[model samples]
Target: MTADKIKAAALAHFANHGYSGASLSGIASDVGIKTPSIYAHFKNKDELFLAVTEEAIAREWEQATAYFKNRSSSFKEKLYGFLRSQKENYDEDERAKFWLRTSYFPPEHLHDQVMKDVYNLLDKMETLLLQEFKEAKEQEPQLNSLNIEHAAKAYIALLDGVFVELLYGGERRTEERLEASWYMYERALFS
Candidate 1:
């Protein structure tokens, strides 16, 4: 329970104030614990930050994967579900802000670490997507024209682009933009 509290506090801290700007003391204060007590759970701020990020990423992936798992529809339907899930995931208040901040203005020194995490997450996601794409091709040989890897990358990039827009635009506008992007993606991928 204490570890969960620490992680929750760290998420808010990192989301509100980037890595360099967030302080362990501030996180401890939010959790109603002394700064030193954090050490019992985390070796240092870096480890804590990574833990928070990992948890968030894992949650997001779990949600998406589950959405895909029970889906019993065409590949396009599954892909559309995935896209809608991406938009919804990025629409969350704290999570959306944290992702936007990190994507656009990550700490300079932690660039490698950030990239590593992103790549690792994507690699895991891609494995699942690759299997889906292979099944899609087997089901509908016409989809052979679309390169699965390229399509996956494009879909991911589209979500990232939509996420950036949502960060700048307010809620209503973001929804409109996401819908438009979704339609465009559907046409591009399915037709």
Candidate 2:
């Protein structure tokens, strides 16, 4: 579909060249269409960028939520599964990489929008994590001793840190760091 093609091209362009550097004409050309044809699917470049970001975030959430939904295990198992899922989500596809890059570092003009989007995404993720923490507390009374809010925030921060490190370092190092962080988190929260 033209819409998908546009999104794919936009994502690639945005990833390689921030928002301002990427042009609608270039995306249209990537899709083998005229610049005006993009107007049919998106009213403007901002709309197109937002659409691509929303789609990428939705897909990532869908994958993570689905994985969590099918899992029925102990709270510790669920926690580990969630950590692994978060890593997998960060090992994103091209579109997702674009979204992540923009979320963390966007063009000056689009920085506000990117910040708002990142806050919204983080809020949603925090809500999900808080629910998991609450469930863990209910299932294991020992978790009651832990500060659920602090633990949840720490867990999210740990994932974010690992993502940044992985982007620079390779998968093997990332995995090692992730495991080390996971152990620390598990010991602190579960033990």
Candidate 3:
């Protein structure tokens, strides 16, 4: 229970402050414990940060799985739905902000570790996407000419571009950019 509380506090701090700026004392205070009490759950800030990162990534996967399973009728629907859904972040959701920041600029010391973890998550996501693309190509005669591997890679690249816009462009700008970019991408794919 204490460990959960510690991690919960740490998540919020890390989300807003990033790895380097997050403060153990701040997290401890938020958890209603002294700074040293955190040592009982985590050896140091690095461990706590990694724990938070793992939990955050797990939560994202859970959400994605649920969304993928329940939403959309066809493969194109699911793909486009996922792309569109990615554009909608809760205004108060710091986790999304934290994820964007960490993806682009992890702590210098933990960059490799963070990238490894993120890439692992992306691998799983892409594998799922590839299966969908394969099925879609098999079902849609028009799509048979498209290479599933290339299509999947291009889709992932588009998603990454969205993330980049979300990181640097504010909400209004991202919305405009996403609308225009997604239209162009769809035209290029189908035309």
User: Clash pairs of candidate 3?
Assistant: none
lDDT (tens digit, per residue) of candidate 3 on 1-191:
99999988887887778887889999999989999999998999988888878877887788678877763487666777777777774245766666767778889999999999899888988887788777778787878788888878888888888888787777887778777777876776666
Lowest lDDT 10-mer window, candidate 3?
A: 89-98
Ranking by TM-score: 3, 2, 1
lDDT: worst 10-residue window of model 1: 91-100
Given candidate 2, what's the lDDT at residue 99?
A: 66
Q: After superposition, how far is residue 48 of candidate 2 from its true place, in Å?
A: 1.5
For model 1, the superposed segments whose C-alpha errors exceed 4 Å read 93-100, 141-144
lDDT of 2 by residue, 80-137 (tens): 7766766675675676668667777766767787688778878888888888788778
Q: Model 2: residues >4 Å from true position, as ranges?
A: none
Instruction: Please give the lDDT score at residue 127 for candidate 3.
Output: 84
Residue-pair clashes per candidate: 0, 0, 0
* Residue 30 of model 2, lDDT score: 93
Badly placed stretches (over 4 Å) of model 3 are 90-92
Candidate 1 C-alpha lDDT tens digits along 1-191: 99999989888888888898899999999999999999999999888877877777777678768876874777887777766666676665576567557756667777788777777777877777877887787778678787888877777777766776766786787778777877887787777
Clashing pairs in 2: none
| Candidate 3 CA-lDDT value | 0.80
**Which has the higher lDDT value, candidate number 1 or candidate number 3?**
3
